[model samples]
Target: MKILTIQQIIKNIENEVVFEAYAEDESFKIKIDEYIPYVCAAIHDGGQMRDDVLEKCSLSTYERWYEEDPHTAEFVGNFPILIQGCDSRFEYDLNRDPDNAIYEEAWGKNVWETPLSESQKQRSLAKHHAFYEVVEALIQKLESKFKKCVVYDIHSYNWKRWDRPVPVFNIGAELVDHQKFGDYVESWRDGLSLIELGDIHNYTAVNDVFYGRGYLLGFITNKFKDTLVLATEVSKIYCDELTGESFPEVINQIKEGFKTAILNHAFEFIKNETSYKVSKQVNILHNELESDLIKIDKQLYSLVKDFELLSVINPINLEFEKKKFLASNYKYEPQFKYNPLNIDPFEFKRKLSNIKVEKINDISIQNMYVDTINAYFDKVDLLANLGTNKFLYNSLRYFGEPSKKDVDNANFVLYCPEFRMEKEGEFNENEVVELFKNATQDYGFQFDIEVSDHIASKALVINSKKKVVIKKGVKFDKRFTKGLIEHEIGVHMVTTMNALKQPLKIFSIGLPVNTLTQEGLAILSEYYSDSINHDRLRELGLRVLAVNMLTSGKSFNETFLTLMEEYKMAPENAFYLTTRVYRGGGFTKDALYLKGLKTILNYIDQGKKLDNLLIGKTSVEYVDTIDELVDRKMINSPQYFTKIFKKHLEKPEINPILQYIFNGIKD
Candidate 1:
């Protein structure tokens, strides 16, 4: 940030140069990331008073802070253009007109024991004049460049002082040209109502607590006909109004929610003004934080690749052990030896914790990046504990254990007569590889196919390496081959390819708990392709049951016996299922397949779009943020989509029994 004189600031605006600076006198600050059509101003967000002025004032420091709009600038700091005052409003309120700028009394109390001298009054008024001069120059430049402008005049009020219940947000718009921009005013008010600040339910109304009577609004509205100033105020719910202690978590939530609401509101304003045709040149602003995020993402990717759980957890001598366990009459547990760890788990977790997410100007992006980093922390911890007794605890921390509802739902599906159908296949592992190769060709992407004896599943995709591994001797039913291809190549591989093309590498690496959404989407693909059957649905339910049993402290032999005797599963199939849950000391991720499917089903039932969800390894919860990023052109749409999803889009279909089963499951 640079310090520049008023004339230099005006010259930079006139030249359309982007910069961040403070006025030479240090009365205010301005940051221009890009000269967009909107501006954010926090005129009363300061409590700094000159020594001379402070000496004459009768009010204490707490009194001054009570009247000032603290942290108001931070609420809209993510915007492209921002200007905020740094001097105490008690000296000369920036929101008041110049004629009455210096206050003699405030909030029905005397402001000074001795009135300020003529020289002191002139000094305070000079800062006020300089602030409006810069504001005029800014609006002039925006109107000249974009033909219209919107200003978010941010402030905060003391809600506790009111005798009656008041709204969380109050928009003062009485002084604006409502006849011309009445819809925009109402839209802004409605947008504020969407902000979620922890336990505080947001309530917004126009001209409820205070009208738009500030000098800043009057000055801008009178000077620029094309400009609309929205006087947005938030009650002091984010802090202890009486004690002045702030709740950081609540403040963070407010900042995150406010960023999305204001940006969406601004985009709508511009779309309406430009007749719904936004120019490509109007790009989202980027900063140094992008590079910082990329560095952290790369570090996380490297750590994850070194700790692929399947490669480390699957036993090398599986066939020999299976024969021995069967020969011992299923009394002796299988002795499993795992592959060596490439990196120490403790050291890996330390590295993950060391990588910090810096404070980003864009609150929405910052929140996403922060969440991704925290998710990585849990992932590294889980990976470090692989093959140990502690692994189950870490797995529970990362991938939560199935609830009683999940177990009941799984048992329901297992017992349902409609899901008892079974079928046989003639295709071998080699034939499955050939099918995958052809499927990749049709999808316009290439992935290496190799049959390996180490993996436990029939086939799985190592998305980061762009490779598919098939179990060496497994057989796949010919009817299920197409659905398997759609599951791996169509959904997982497509999202991987799309994530690799993103500017931020975190998408390619995957988000926290992305496994749940990714697996759910894959199953949905199979259903849409008409390859899903009752047998497949039952298998998903059994996996959920297996996970629940393992989490409930059932031993490998106990779980295997229950599956073979009680569930009527084949001996060999029961062993495989038990091994899947008991591997790496009680893995519990299998339960997510059923839960995730239900989540996706409910998401689609709400009439939400899938294009955003398919953009990368993102979850259903982040669809709105992805859509916002697409609107801002920060990221592009997915290059490859599930053929089944596209077909479903044209003509949607779902199995009646599948819908009934999921609809019966409780949230």
Candidate 2:
């Protein structure tokens, strides 16, 4: 959190232009943390080479040359040392691309002139290659631990050509993957407040301006595509034009902006695997359901042609065991075990569609909230009744009065109903829904309100047409509605709509085993300002706390009691809410908060592009088993909603802490 300091950052840069430390602070530690031994090694090598080059002239002559405006001398002095331990040839030329003997803009000089000077050539190869070789080795080592790696080949460029005018910052002129590098570079632009001067200095790779083909880029790209090489070329504005004098102000600014950019990308790159893993897992699960319903069962037809599913042919028992293991683990987690009702895993496993059911309560809220529960159940039943073979829904009838177990298993339950007397007149339930629709169009989502006379508890469900069923008299507070909209419409409905658009209804029916990312994505939708409010943030925070509690093995009763007695939540409210946190015993609510936060933050960091999170464009671990199917085109993109939500997604800048967490590789 401390402001930028010099030593911490300069020590990390291959060439500092000048070696002077100014101001010590925490930001320095963060910057220094990103400097692996590479900076030291590169500088050390460059130093040694400088001495060797200077050996040709006398000490007096060298000192006098240096005295004539020492910044260039300082740079030359540090250069050899920086690259000391590297292979001056086979590895990286530092000044030129490794594959070429001459720079791309060497003014047509035959830079590789000494055909007979094998010794000189070998020395160049040995010295230059050593630096790049060490770089390559370091990259490989880093890649083993991370999903990607980055190489910041630091250098300074004179903006004013002898024959031309000076330009602004020269971002490695061209051949760079703009899509992959744009975000990070943009971060630099923001951090530095640099003005755009058109594309004057933005030459593509190997153009007339300072082109070097066989440099670090060649070595880096050849071995690893994931390894990003940034050849930063700072202008000579910091040096005296006539005498090449040094200016501390310019140096400080470049160091600050440079450090920010590197640290930012480094953090994201390191955490990339975890996020991608979770996303991929979700994708796999999504694709699998589509495949099972459309390809195997042949009950649903594809609405989109490219939708494909990747199937894993594990033995049936193994699949069952895996599912059971997850369920058991979920149930045993501290937050999940707080429920009082019994969950029948048998009933859950017996039903093969993507839906899961848990018995939430025993106090006869079943018949008590029949009006609400019945409508939800019947709507799901209607879908099943409609000849959809791939998607299935199971119900967990509450066996006991609300308990920790019950709350954990069910999404939400209606407290004993508080009847709201219509201001004056009574209307039919269907008519009421139409009225509500007209009233809330300014909001979003169309609700299919069904007042159930037979039900005591209020529950919610979404049908294929995207109509939501809520028991009448359920308190329509901001929390309930926001959570409902985010979970149902954003995730379930959108995914369903996309699936339906697929040439096959199987994808439309539902996705299997996609709980993690599905739930993560669903919960993330609640954070948007358009949908979320103070009440929603509170609910989400509690959910996160619940996940932490459940994973620590808190029982359902304990969790319920804790929420009510300790957190001072209302008894009925606490009991009902605790059930959700404690369900699946542990795994149920555990995912909604932390995992959801991570997913949402990542989406923002990636610029709020929902295409990846929604259209299944994510990694296997972070997603479901269905990714393979989507990859294979077994599942198709949703035509109606994908584009609509795409613009709303915004990738936010990576936070420094998370970036610090991911600094391992970039360092």
Evaluated with lDDT, which candidate comes out highest?
1
Give the Å error, residue 217, model 2. 36
The deviation in Å at residue 178 for candidate 2 is: 34
Best candidate (score: TM-score): 1
Please provide, for model 2 over 1-667, each residue's C-alpha lDDT reduced to its tens digit, 9 standing for 90 to 100.
3433333333334332322221231100111222221221222122222333334322233222222222222221111122222122111245565445413223333222223244544555554554444455555644554556555554555544547653344446354555776565444434334432232242222223443243566667678767665554445665655454667555434443443344444444434522233222212111222222324223222221222211001111322332443456334322211112122333422332322111211111111222222333432332232212221122112111223432332222112122222333334445544544553353344445455422212333343434555444445554345445455555555565555445534334333324445665665554342344333434444555555455456666666666666656665555445545433322232333434445455655654435534652222133322333446454564443432244344543433432332222110
Q: Local error of candidate 2 at 125, Å?
A: 56
Error of 2 at 43 (Å): 56
The positional error of residue 69 in candidate 1, measured at the CA in angstroms, is 2.6
Question: Where is the poorest 10-residue window by lDDT in model 1?
Answer: 280-289
True-vs-predicted CA distance for residue 346, candidate 2, Å: 8.5
Model 1 RMSD in Å is 4.3
lDDT of 1 by residue, 1-667 (tens): 6899999999999999989999998899998977778889998988888899899999999998999999888888877789999999999999999989999999998999998999999999999999999999999998888888899999999999999889898999998898888899998888788887767878889999999899999999999998999998889998999999988787788788777677678888876673334543224343334445567667767666444555667778777778888888899888877776777767776776776654455666667766776776776666677778998888888789998888888888777766525575558988899889998899878789999877777778887678899888877887678789899888988898888777766677777788889998998888777776776777888899899888889999999999889887888778877887888888888899888887888888888877877878897666766776777667878878788899888987877776676677636
TM-score of 1: 0.84
